[model samples]
Target: MKRFIKSRGGMTGFVLLAFLILIGLAGPLLVPFRDAGRHWHDIEYWQDSPAAVPPVWVRGPWNAGKLARSGRLQGKDPVLFESEGGGGRAVWRFMLSKEAKPMRLDLILVIGGEGKRPVLVSSVGDDGAETEVARRLFEVSVGQPARLALSLDGARALTVTEYLLPGETARDSPSIVLVGQVSGLLGTDVSKRDIFTGIVLGLRWALLLGVAVSFLTVMTGIVLGISAACWGGWVDTALNRIYEFFALMPILPFLIVLSAVYKPSLWAFAGLALLFFWTKAFKPVYSMALQIREEGYIEAGKSIGAGKMRRAFVYVLPALLPYGFAVMALSVPGIIMYEAGISMLGLGDGTVVTWGQMLHDALVQGAVINRLWWWILPPGLMIALTGITFALLGRGFERVWSPDRGSRPTGAGPSRSGT
Candidate 1:
């Protein structure tokens, strides 16, 4: 651990990994998101919110950035969507822009005089469907942003009656004001799924996969490799054959088939990933274990009546610890890549929320085409950064493990005395 921190490469990897782990542990508790896995229920909170709301901090003050509803405006107020006379029916068509998203429609009109008992507020969709947005008879403040929940449900127009009240005068109908949502620091996707929340939840899945698959493959491979090496002859031949066979296995296709056949699960995909790379640790571990097996320590253990299990595990395994650590660290990036690749391909479980799926949505939704780089870049950058962490760690561990290299692990003594 001291050596790891001292080395620049190792330190770089360790910091990157540690920060991601912290987020994985604490992100869920901090973010305000109802569902990270599926976003269908998110509509209840946002109710047809405008899609792709940019992060506020970066949206400099302009016509685009203005969302205030406090004081009266000099010219026509955009938020106050429509206003006209009262007495007859009037249809205010809000033509949907190409960049339009799910939006909750809101109506706010100040009735000057007295009006009829009933005034209707309805949202009309492009398909000519009518859904009631609101129905009110109460008086509204002369000017204010009402704190009321409304749903446009993808409507393209809002139609209201221009009804006149008694006490004298002209038609004074309700004016429309569309209150768009400015989500969190990161805003939302087309589906109104919060991107920040997705990133937060994804930290857990990514870390779980990177660590689990790394440890599982190295430990399993080392055990099998040492067994083959220590107990040679038929055992060595058979293990080598098995390793070679599995090494040649068409891993991706097999996983794709299984994903189709069974339900997609994180653990299940992890298991398949284990199969794909477990053999990677075997050959190197076997070579080193064989050298250690012929050492004086092995003879000493054997003369003292240490059983094969005790000899291999208690006496021999310690010599291979450095190799194990290096293999584990290096193998992590591949495992994460494999899991994310399959997921991005839509072979992963639909219910799981992963970075790969986030990227997949970006691609499918033409986020790149629309220049919504935020939707696509984050997940890709994370994947690359994670791979870099493992790569650096692997290099550092490799240097420490080499016989003639820097500080070595315990039991990695010189060939003469240590043997």
Candidate 2:
């Protein structure tokens, strides 16, 4: 571990990977919407949020343009005035702060009653100009709730724009609820889903897929390679043939076809990835196993009646473990990329929130054409950083385990004096 951190690349990779892991573990807790991961694709859940807005931090200290922030004013605190025939007027005066220069606004009114009521929603500006934003006849059952959504972006865009001017205050009457313009740490997507939440949730999936696939593949490879080398003859020939077949297979095309046909879940896709990935470390492990088998220790074990399985498991496996760790670390980036590529093509599991799925959505929704950099850049940068993290860690492991490091192979037995 000390040696691994001594290298600048390895230290940087460790810090980066640790930061990513920390986000995966702790980010969701810090986010305002804890259930964003579950409701990411549910448009209704995100209905109150602004669509396709940049992050709040973009405003910076300069206070660039008038950026709208999401806010809601419920009817619970309305000032009521009694009128004739039991019909009354409820007014909600919400101050639009000098900082909240909204580009657009939405008013949602929830009315619960037995008969139709003529509701007039108006906005009051600092100049005492009262503009009627929306007027509607809200009909509701005795207990049932009816929702009316009125966008100030339509014909009233000019009226609302004046009210939202910087350094001015505005008020909405009759319990008008304003929803969305810009919100959240990373802002909202076209669907109004929080991008930061999606990215944070995606970290776990990325790490899981990368680590799980790499571990399974490398372990399988090491076991099979050792078995083939130790048992030799028919076992060696058959295993090598299988390894070669998988090694030469066009995995991407095959995965695409299979995924298109089956539409498998993330775990299923991981299993599919493992089928080909296991071959990556096979040749190297096989060569090393062959060398270990030829070592004098193996002859000593055999003379002492040590079985083939015992020798392979108790002796050979340990020596190859360092190499296995190096290969596993190296293999993670490729596995992650493979999953991301499939996901970007829309062949990945749809139910999960992943970096690749985010990219795919960005592509389909024309994020680039619309210049929604927040949507595309975060996931892309994360994928790149993750790849770099594992690559550097793998290099560090390679440095430690390389034969040129002058460390004796563990399978060579202890020192002569100790022996």
Q: What TM-score fits each model?
A: 0.71, 0.82
Task: For residues 1-419, write the lDDT of model 2, one tens digit per residue.
Answer: 66676778777877888988888889768777798777778887777677898887786555543555665655445555554544455555555444334344565656554555556666655455678866677666764556777765322222211112233232232333455556777877899888888888888899988998999999999999999999899999999999989999999999999989996579888888889999988998998888788677777898899999988988899989988888988898898888888999999988889999999999999999999999999998888889999988888877667736565455757533345
Error of 2 at 144 (Å): 7.9
Off by over 4 Å in 2: 61-65, 73-91, 99-120, 127-146, 150-181, 403-408, 415-419
Q: Give me the runs in candidate 1 sitting further than 4 Å from their true place.
A: 38-48, 61-182, 403-419
lDDT of 1 at 302: 79
Candidate 1, residues 126-237, lDDT tens digits: the string is: 5678887677665435443223344555666655543343332333343443445454656667876767778877778888888888998899999999899888899999
Question: After TM-score superposition, what is the CA distance of residue 104 in candidate 2 from its true location, in Å?
Answer: 6.0
Error of 1 at 29 (Å): 3.3
The local lDDT score (0 to 100) that residue 72 gets in candidate 2 is 61
Using lDDT as the measure, which candidate wins? 2
- Could you say which candidate leads in TM-score? 2
**lDDT computed for candidate 2:** 0.76
